[model samples]
Structures are given as structure tokens and as C-alpha cells.
Target: MIPAINIDAALAALTDHWSPKVVARVNDQYVKVAKLKGEFVWHRHDDEDELFQVVRGRLRLQFEDGGETVLEPGELCVIPRGVMHRPVAEEECAILLVETVTTKHTGDVETPRSRSIAEQLA
Candidate 1:
């Protein structure tokens, strides 16, 4: 039998902010967890949509269109492919993400906070 994963335990093991760790896989997608604080770079995935779910604290997604959405714990948002967005948190926040295996952590732009697939898998 496949062992169940303890999300809290997985989250606790993370020591870096803005870095995502892969926790599971579903077909062509990856389920990841990340601890984030401060603002992230603006980027867009041309072909893969991304899903963001707040696990703790809060998250604010700022869109290139000048619109923004704030998500509290248990809340989730689906970012359509090709829509530019940046994620920001006033304090440390935990989040779960679902994205295609081909999706880039920073989408179209690479920043200092970006994490590669290999890094995330490791």
C-alpha cells in the first residue's frame, strides 16, 4: 500500500521560503507545497494553468491587469495559463500548488526566488 503523506510534516521539513517541494504526482501534474513570504516575481505560464491553495496564513495574488485577489486559509484560486501574476505575503504563509509537470516555477521569467523542477523534486 502507498503510505499516506502528512502534509503538516512535509511542510515542517521545508526550511526555505519561495522554494517549492514536490509531495505527490497525479498523471502529468505535480502536487507541491511551499512556504512563502514577501513578494514574488511577475510571470506567466503560456500553456499550463496553476492552482494555488492556502494552507496557512494569507496570500495575495497581484495580476498584471491591476487586479488582485486575497486568499485566506482553506481558500484556493486557479490562475489561467498566460495570465501574468505575482504572489505576495505580508507574513510567512504555507500553500499547496498543483501544476503540470512542464510548468516552470517562475513561468516566463526567472528570478532569484525561482526553483527548478530538479530542485523541487530533490
Candidate 2:
């Protein structure tokens, strides 16, 4: 049975930056919690839109077209599929990510920060 999943507890269990842990699943998407800081590589999923919810601190989503969006607690944003973007957090930030189960953490450009679905599930 899927028990009640606590976001705070789920976030607290995370110990790495840019690494997402699967906390729940709704239909074809995976609900994940991650601790983030610094800057992530610029990449885009070819066919999956990615959702980010700011749970703590702040997040800056930078786009390839020189645009950006800052997210505060309780704020969420969705990056449409195929949009090149990168995530940066000046300080440690906690966030919830919702995306298809097949979505790669860093899209096609694999970096040291990339986390596989199997790794996320573990």
C-alpha cells in the first residue's frame, strides 16, 4: 500500500544536490523531492515537460533565450518539452519535481549530476 508521503520527511532524506528521489507516482509521472544548490547544466528533455515546485529557498530557472524565472516557496513552474533551460540556486534549496517516469534528470546531456530513474527510485 502507498502510505501518506510527507514532503518534509521526504526532502530531509535527501543528501545530495541535483539528485532527485522518487517519493510518489501519479499516473505516468513521478513525484520527486530534491535538494539543490549551485548550477546545473543546460539541457532539455525532447518529449517531456518538467515541473518544479519550490518548497524552500529560491530557484532561478534560466532559459537559453536569456530569460529566467525565479521561484519562491509555494511557487511552481513548468518548462515545456524541448525548451533548453538550466536551474540555479544561490543557496541550498528544496524542491519537488514532477515529470514523466522516462524523463532524464539532465536530458540528453549527461553530466556528473545526472541521476537515472533507477537511482532515483532507490
Candidate 3:
């Protein structure tokens, strides 16, 4: 049976900055939420594409190729596998991330700034 998803209930569970809260799963994918501020690390997933949806804030995704896109509330974007991208925000914002179970939030590039994918899944 498919689990019911209550957006309000899910959003209520999130209470940290940049820490993702997993709320739903579809196949090998997870629907995750987090509060973003400042900047994230540049990373890439070799085998999974990622989707980013802004729920209550704005975010800017910077690509290694020197291009970037700002995702406003209600807008979303997909980041392809093996591409380097970093998420940045000017202030506190809510965001939902969708990706395969194997996809890392920080991709292959690890740094102190990288939020552990496992931790987020929990």
C-alpha cells in the first residue's frame, strides 16, 4: 500500500538548518526536506539524478561550469548525475530534495560542509 503524505505534517518535523528530514520513499528514491542557509558544498552523484524543489524559500544552484540558477518558492530543478553543483541561500528557506536512495546529498566531493546522506535519510 502507498503511504499517505501530509505536507504539513512532514514540514512540522523539520527543525534544523541544512539537515534533511526524509518523509517519503518511492522506489529507490526519497522525498527529503531541509532548511537551507548560506552555501553547500560542490559535489556530484555518478549514477543518480537529483531534483530540488523550493517549498518556502529561495535557493541558488551554482554549477562548476560557472553558471547558476535561482529556484524560487514553488519552483524546482533537476541536477543530472556526474555534474558538480552547490546550493546556496541568502537566508533561511525550506526545500525538498528528490533522488535515488544511492544518491548522496554531497555527491563524490566530501568536505566538512557536506551533509551526510545517511544521516539525512534517517
Candidate 4:
């Protein structure tokens, strides 16, 4: 039997900001946890939608249209495929991400904070 995952424990194991680690997988999707403290790159997934659920603190997703969505704990938002957005956190934040197995971390844009799938899995 598979063991249950403690989200808080999984989060505690993370030490890097903006780097997400794969915690679980359901069908073709991956459940990831990440810590954020600053601004992320503006990017979009061309073929896959992304789900962001705030576990702690606050997160603001800024869109290309100059609008933004702020999420607090227990709140979630879904970013549609091909929509450009950036996540910003004035304070440290913990988030849960649900995306397809093939989704890239920063879409097609490579940045210093970008992590490869292998890195995430590790």
C-alpha cells in the first residue's frame, strides 16, 4: 500500500525558493510543492493548464493584461494554457501545484531559477 503524504512535512524539506519538488503523481499529473518569496518569470504553458493552491502565506499572480489575482491560504487558481502570468510573493509562501507530467517549469523561457524535470524529481 502507498503511504500518505504530509504536505507540511514535504514543504519543510524544501530549502530553495521558486524551486518546486514533485511530491505525488495522479494519472498523468504531478503534484508539486514550492516555496516562493519573490517574483517569478512571466511565462505560459502552451499545451497544459496549471493549478496553484496556496497552502500558506500569500501569492499574487500578475497577468499580461495588467490584472492580478491574490491568493491566501486555502485559495486556488487555475491558469489556462497559453496565458502569460507571473507569481509574486512579498512574504514567503508555500504553494501546491498540479500540472501535467510534461509541463515545463518556466514554459519556453529559461531563467536562473528554472528547474528541469529531472531536478524536480530528484
Candidate achieving the largest lDDT: 4
Per-residue lDDT of 40 in model 1: 90
TM-score of each prediction = 0.98, 0.97, 0.88, 0.99
Computed on alpha carbons, the lDDT of every model, listed in order, comes to 0.96, 0.96, 0.84, 0.98
Flag regions of model 2 displaced more than 4 Å.
none
lDDT of 1 by residue, 2-97 (tens): 989898999999999999999999999999999999999999999999999999999999999899999999999999999999999999999999
* Candidate 3 wrong stretches, greater than 4 Å: 1-3, 113-118
Candidate numbers sorted by lDDT from highest down: 4, 1, 2, 3
Inter-residue clash pairs, candidate 2: none
Which should have the higher lDDT, number 2 or number 4?
4
What C-alpha lDDT, on a 0 to 100 scale, does residue 93 get in candidate 2?
99
Which 10 successive residues of model 3 have the least lDDT summed? 109-118
Q: On TM-score, who's better, 2 or 4? A: 4
Tell me each candidate's RMSD, in Å, in order.
0.6, 0.9, 1.8, 0.5
Error (Å) of candidate 1 at residue 26 is: 0.4
Q: List the residue pairs that clash in candidate 4.
A: none
lDDT comparing candidate 4 with the true structure? 0.98
